[model samples]
Every structure is written in C-alpha cells, then in structure tokens.
Target chain A: MKLTILGCYSATPRTDTNPTSQVLEINNHMFLIDCGEGTQVELRRNKIKFARIKHIFISHLHGDHFFGLVGLISTFRLLTRETELHIYCPKGLKEVITLQMKLADSWTNYQLIFHELTSTESELIFEDDKVQVFTIPLDHRVYTNGFLFKEKAGDRHLDMDAVLNANINVAYYRKLKQGYDVVNEDGVLIDNNKVTTDPNPPKSYAFCSDTAYNEAIIPIIKGVDVLYHESTFLDQHASLAPKTKHSTAKEAATIAKKAKVKTLVLGHFSTRYDNLNDFKSEAQTVFESVELADDGKTFNFD
Target chain B: MKLTILGCYSATPRTDTNPTSQVLEINNHMFLIDCGEGTQVELRRNKIKFARIKHIFISHLHGDHFFGLVGLISTFRLLTRETELHIYCPKGLKEVITLQMKLADSWTNYQLIFHELTSTESELIFEDDKVQVFTIPLDHRVYTNGFLFKEKAGDRHLDMDAVLNANINVAYYRKLKQGYDVVNEDGVLIDNNKVTTDPNPPKSYAFCSDTAYNEAIIPIIKGVDVLYHESTFLDQHASLAPKTKHSTAKEAATIAKKAKVKTLVLGHFSTRYDNLNDFKSEAQTVFESVELADDGKTFNFD
Candidate 1:
C-alpha cells in the first residue's frame, strides 16, 4: 500500500502550503480523500494519472476540504472522460455541484454518481473482494467522517517441498491453496496444514483529519498499520485547539499510542507555525513511530 | 494606469497555463477582473496586497472565469478581514456563491455586497471621482461582459511661469486650475487657456475577452489607449472560432485596427497551439503596435 499527500495544511491554502487532500492506493485501487483547492494542479505536479481517480471521498463541506471537487469534475468533462465517476460526500454536496453545472450549461459526458453520507454511526460504506472501507465518526464542528481502508485476507500459500513429500498431485494444488484437506493418490488422507502455510497478513490504513481529539474513534481504528491524524497546533496553542475543533500534536500522539497503531503520521498543520520539526518532536514523546506529512510527500507500507 | 496579467488562457486552467484573470490598477484603485481557478494563488505569487482588492468583477458564470472567487472570499474571512467586499457579475452568480457560504455555515464578518448585471447594452457599471468603468457587452456561450476602465479627466495643470506673469494671486490658483478666468490685481482679463495647458489626456483601457468577432463595440471603445482582445484561435482554426463564440487572432486585430486604439494586446490563446509567436505574426498582418498578454507580464501606461 502507498499513500501520497497532495496537500496537508489547515484552513486556507497559501502560495507555499495547500489544504487537506491525499491519495491512498491499496489493492489496486486509488482512492482520493478530501480534495482541497488546487488539488488538480497538485495531481499534475505529482504525475498521477487523473483517470485513475475513479472514487473521491470528501470528509465535509468546508471549502478547505471539498472546494476543488467541482473543478476536478469539470476538468474530467473537458478531458472527454468516458468512465463513470463516484463521489462520496455529505448530503449538501450534490446540490452545490449540480447548480454550477446547470449555470454553465455544461454537463459531463460521462456518468456522474453521488453517494451522500449522513449516518453518525460507524458503518461500512464500501466493500469488495479485495478491500473494505468503513466510516469513523469524528468530532468536529461540522458533520464529518474519517475513512478506514483495510485489505481483505488472501488465500493460503502452498509449501512446495511439503506438498511433494505428501505425494499430492499437481491438479490438487488449488485445493491446498484454498486450505482444504484432500486424499492422496494412494488413498491416504492428507491434512491441509501439512502442505500449506498462512498467507501474509493484510494491512490497513486509517485517515482522520480536521477533527478534535476524540477517544471514541480509537476503538474503531485500533491496530491499524498506519494512522494519519490531524495535528493542527502545538501544545502552546492547546487552549485554542479544542475551541476550533482541532487537535494538538501531543493530543494526536496520545490517540496514536492508545489506538496501538503501527505508525502515526501527523499532518494538517496550522499555517501560523513556521517550524514543523516541533510537531514531530512533540508527537514522539508518546508515540515511538511518528512521521510528518507534508505536501508532495509519499509513504509506502508493505 | 498599470495592468497585471494574472492568467491569460482560454477554457480550463492547467499546470503550466492558467485561465482568464487580471488586475487593473488605475487612479489608486486595484480592480480584479475575471477571477479564474487558482487566482488566489496567482495573486499571492504576484505579491499583491489582498486588502487592496475591495472590488472583484466577474465576466460570466463559467467556472474558468469565476471559480476562484469563493475560495478567495473565504480566505479573507480566515484572515480576519473586516473590510467590505463588492462583487459585480451576471445575475446568477449571487445565488451560487451564497449557497456555498450557507452550506459551509461560515459567513464573513465583513459586509458582502453583490451587484448583478443583466444589461445587453454598454452601460456604466462603476464610477468614482477619478475613474469610471463600463460593461463591454460580449458574445459568448453564456451571458458575459468585458470591462472597460477609463480614467476621468483630471484638474488642469498650472503653468507656474504663466500664472506669475499674469499676476494671479496664490489663493486664486485653485480657480485657475478649475479652468476659470480670474480677475487679476491689475484688473486685466487673462485667458485661462493662456495660463494653463490641458491635463494629461484621459487614458482608457478596454478589455474584451471570450467574445466572437463583434464590431458593434468598436464605436464604444474607439481610440482607447489600450485594448485587450481575446484571440482564442489562429487563422488555421478560424472555422471553430464562431461556433465556440471565440475570436481568431486576425479577427481581434481587425477590431483593434478599426477602433484605432493606440495599443492592442492579444491574449486568451487556446491550448491547441504550441507556438504563440504565430498568433502575434498573424495579428500584425492587420494591425500595428500589437502586444501579447502573458501570465505575470505587467503593462504600464503613462
């Protein structure tokens, strides 16, 4: 699995800094999360193929999170895209986008579908053979949901030497990989565990941003391989953090430690601070594995 | 008068090229015209003072012309701006912008005013003591208008030598500048024309973009100091010009020549052409003193 940070700042987008947006690639699926302003330009700068983004997930209706969505959709239309696009966002987003399209009198040539989300409970939003996505209800001023992407468990790996010793026929390899016991050529019963070992463990990633420090989501995102949490401010501005429905670096680290995630990535920094090293230092006090996410940064997990 | 080209291209904004937007500074007023997507970032890159941009003029409801407006307004609010902002555009723009603001639940602290324009005739849209702006009705896919900024005639310059020779009192100098024949101490009737020359000739700039070859506006913008006309295509694709409601380079030059403007600026070139010099060469065939408008290029008129 790989993740690319298209933008990782909070509030307004500056010349050097962008707002919240990222791309997560797992199980051959490229899922776009929280398209901020100027995301299309960032996608081009990063050389990511625009057509690969079939599904876009918006956390909220704030300008910083979903303002770029309409432009991106318009660009896709301009590019003469034929593939259908899916948008999973709050209920109000459909009206906002369709109104602009009506004004311009320019509708997409491709099919455009919208999945409006309104549930406050943690629910599974999407599932396929290879991956599953669930919503992590977050604490924020507005209705917001953080997405968790988990790879589905695969079939068992066959041990070639053990299968050869068991005198298993080559035609029965598929059954062994499927973890089923089969009879050998001599009518001897062979156990599946003797010829096959377990497959690699599935990995999962959780993305949470523009939210306050809430312990309620920790149980849902527990034991994730990587957790991206918003750390908009440092401890010095701790008083302003909760008031603004944001989290400080120390608070994010505390959540990471309590959730027992394998790795923690702190991002969505406030533009007021100039130094970013302090965020990592503060997060490291509680979480041993901490990384800082910046614009154009990419993280890889195996 | 100083004009800064923030973006000068047609249709969608790309990584290297931007859509239509410019900043015209005349008579100590900074007027932002046609804010396209990514315009706020371009303004920051140009190092323009955000507080000075009190008025924004949108040409049409097309996303390329006014998509960046809401983001800019939101940024002002985030910056704690208390200054009022004025937006002048087509009739439908107010509803589109206000709807987004309502959905976000974040209203500006400052007063936001909207002036919707629906006239098909050339009419005065804005005016002050020092400058006046009129709408140059344009032909396009939607209801669009190009802006014409003109500096009002200033106070007559006082010829100090001529004034003293006429024995005019210092207190009455103001009357002379106002073009009044004042009574001298010697009771001699002195002509005001003999003492003062005409103030710098009133300079005007006409911006006509995203329009087809329409000669009806030639009489309105006749003999202006500078004329910016859109040349979205070359002679090779002249057939596509009228169908798209755009103009060719030759068509733009023909208008400039017929209007007898002092200088002509050709911009809004389509992305299909790789070489821009062809546009200049093609335009010069019909008119002289043709300049190209490019992103970040500034033109100063004295």
Candidate 2:
C-alpha cells in the first residue's frame, strides 16, 4: 500500500501549499480523498494518471475540501473520458455538481454515480472482494465523514511439503488453502492446520481529517496500520483548536496513542506557522511513531 | 488604459498554460474579465489586489471562461471581505453560482449582485463618471458577449493662454472645461472650441474572444484604441477555425485591419503550437501593429 499527499494545508491554497487532497493506493484501487481547489493541477504535477482515479471521497462540503470537483469533472468531459466515475460525498454535492453541468449543457459521456451520504453514524459505504471502506463519522462545524480503508485477509498458504507427505492430490490443495481438512489419496482426512500456514497479515489505513480531538473514535480505529489525522494547529495555538473544531498536534497524537495505530501521519496544517517541524516534534512527544505530511510527499507501507 | 493578460489560452487549463481571463484597468476601475479556472492564483501571481476587483464580467458559461468565479467568490468570503461584488454574465450563471453557495452553506458576508445578460445585441452594461463598458456581441456556440471598455470623453483641457487672453474669469473656467461657451468678464460670448481642445481623444479598448472570424462587429469597434481578438488557431489549422467557431491569426489580423484600431492584441491561443512568434509574423502580414498576449504579460494603451 502507498499514500501520496497531493495537498495537506488548511484553508485556501497557496503557491507553495495546497489544500486537503490525497491519493491512497490499496487493493488495486486509487481512491482520491477530499479534492480541494487546484487539485487537478496537483494531480498533474504529481504525475498521477487521471484515469486511475475511479472513486472520489469528499470529507465535507467546505470550499477547501471539494471546490475543485466540478472543474475536474468538466475537464474529464473535455478529455473525452469514458470511464464511469463514482463520487461518495455529502448529500448536497450531487445537486451542486449537476447544476453546473446543466448550466454548461455539457454532460459527460461516461456515467456519473453519486453516493450521497447523510448518516451521522459510522457505516459501511463501499466494499469489494479485496477491500472494504467504512465512514468514520467526524465532529466538525459542518457535516463531515472520514473514510477507513481496510484490506480483507487473504487465503492461507498451503505447505507443499506437508501436502505431499499426506499423499494429497493437487485438487485438494485448494481446499487446504481455504482452511479445510481434505481427504487424501489414501482415503484418510488430513488436518488443515498441518498442511497450511497463515497468510500475510492484512493492512488497514484510516483517514480522519477536519475533526476535533474526540476520544470516542479510538475504539473504531483501534490497531489501524496507519492513521492520518488533521492537526491544523500547533501546541502554541492549542486554545484555538477546540473553538474551531480542529485538532492540535498534541490532540492528534493523543488519538493515535489511544488507538494504538502503528503510524500517525499528521496533515492539514494551518498556514500561519512558518515551520512544520513543531508539528512532528509535538506529535512525537505523545506518540512514538509520528510522520508529517507535506505536499507531493509519498509514503510506502508493506 | 492598461490590460493584464492573466490567462490567455484555449480549451482546458494545463500546468503551464491557463484558459481565457484578463484584467483591464480603465480609468480607476480594475475590471476582471472572463475568470477561467485557476484565475485566483493567476491574480495572486500578477500581484493584483483582491479588494480592487469589485466587478467581474464573464464572456460566456463555458467552463474555460467562468469556472474559477465561484472559488474566487468563496475566497473573498473567507478573507472577510465586506465590499459588495458585482458580476455581469449570461443569464444562467447566477443560478449555477448561487446553488453552490447554498450547498456549501457559505453565503458571503458581502452582497453579491448579479446582472444577467440575455441580449444578442451590443448594449451598455457598466458605466461611471470616468468610464463606460458595453457588450461586444460575438459569434460562439453559447450566448456570449465580449466587453468594450471605453474611457468617457473627459472635460476638455482648458487652453490657459487662450482663456487668459479672452479675459475669462476664474469662476467661469469650470464652464469652459465642460465644453460650453462662457460669457467672459466683458459680457462677450466665447466659442468653446477656440479655448479648449478634445481630452486625450477618449481612449477605448475592445476585448473580443472565443469567437469565429466574423466582420459584423467591425463597425461597432471601429477605430478603437486597442482591440484584443481571439486567435485560437494558426493559418495551418485554419480549416479547424471555422468548424470550432474560433479564429486564425491571419483572420484576427484581417479583423484588426478592417476595424482600423491603433493596436491589435491576439490571445486565446490553441495549445497545439509550440512557437508563438509565427502568430506575430502571420498577423503582421495583414496588419502593421500586432501584439501577442501571454500569461503575466501587460500592455499599456494611451
């Protein structure tokens, strides 16, 4: 799995810093999260193939979160893209996007499917054979949702030597990989655990942004492999965090510690501060494993 | 009068090139014309003050022309701008912009007034004591209107030598500047023309873009100080110009020559060409005065 930070700043986009947007690649899917203004250019700058972004997940309706959506959609039509695009966002996004298309009288040749989310509770929103996505209801000034992408556990690996010793046919290897006891060629049942070993551990990533330091989410994201949380303010401005419904570096670290996440990625930084080292330093004090996210940065997880 | 080419290209915005948008500073007003996507950044790059842009004129509803408008409006609100903003665009733009504002639940603190244009003929859209703006009807796929910013004829410059010689009193100098025959101290009526000359010849600028090579607008913009016409294609691709409702460089030069304008600025270039000097060369063949519009380039017209 890999994560690319297209933009990680809060508020408006600047020449050097961009607003919230990222690409998470897992289970053969490239999911675009929170497309802020100027995201299309960022995508081009990062050299990410536009066609690979099949699904888009918006965290909120703020201009910094989803303002670039309509322009990207219109550009897709201009490029003559025929792949069906799916948008999972808040309820009002469909109306906002369709209105512009109607006014331009330029509809996309491909299908545009919208999964308007209104539920405030964490729910399963998308699932496939290899992965599942769940919305982590977040606390914010407006309706917001963070997404958790978890890879499903794979089949157990068969021990070829053990299967051969049991006189098992090649056809029975499939059953053994499925963790089932198989009948051998000698007409005796072979135990599944004796012939098969466990497969590689599944990895999961959770993206939580634009939310306050709420401890209630710790239970839902416990033991996640990687956790990306919004730390809009530093400890110096800790007082402003609660008032603005945004998290400070210390607060995000606390959540990561309580959730016992393997790695904590801090992003959505406020542009008021000149240096980003304070964020990582402050987060590391509370959580041992902490990383800072910057525009055009990429992280690899194995 | 000064014109700043914020973005001057055709079709979609690229990493290096932008779509159609320009800033025309006439009299005291810094009027923004045709705000394409990424225009706010271009404005920042060009060091234009956000507060000075009180009026925005959109040529059409095409995405390349007006997609950046809503984002700019939202950024103003985020900056806590309290000045009222006036937008003059085609009829359907108001609904498209207001709908997004409603969905984001972010109404501007400042008043947003919309002047929707449904006219197919040239008409006055904006005016003040120093300047006047009129629509330049153009041929495009959509209902489009380019703008003609004309400096209203100023008070005639008083010939102080001529006025003093005629024994005119200081109090009646104001009347002479108003281009009126004044009664001198000797109770003699003096001719206005004998004491005053025309003021700066009333400079005018016409912006015509995203249109085909049509001569109907020549009479309306005849003998204007500076004329900006779209030249989306070169002569080699002249066959595509008529089909796409865009003009070639040679065609633009033809229009400029027929209109007899002081200077002709060519813009809205297609991205297919790597060399821009050819456009100047091709246009100079038909018109003596030709200038190419490039992003971040500024032109001074006097």
Largest DockQ belongs to which candidate? 1
Candidate 1 residue lDDT tens string, B25-56 = 99899999998888999999999999999999
Model 2 / residue B203 / CA error / Å = 2.0
TM-scores of all candidate predictions against the true structure: 0.97, 0.94
Tens digit of lDDT per residue, candidate 1, span A36-93?
Answer: 8889989998889999999898998889998888889998999999999989888889
User: DockQ scores for all the models shown?
Assistant: 0.76, 0.61
On the 0 to 100 scale, the lDDT of residue B239 in model 1 is: 99
Candidate 2 wrongly placed segments (more than 4 Å): A157-177, A181-197, B159-169, B181-197
lDDT of 2 by residue, B139-164 (tens): 98778888898898888899999999
**Overall lDDT per candidate, in order of appearance:** 0.92, 0.91
* lDDT score, candidate 1, position A35: 92
Evaluated with lDDT, which candidate comes out highest? 1
Model 2 complex DockQ against the native: 0.61
lDDT of 2 by residue, A258-301 (tens): 99999999999999999999999999899989999999999999
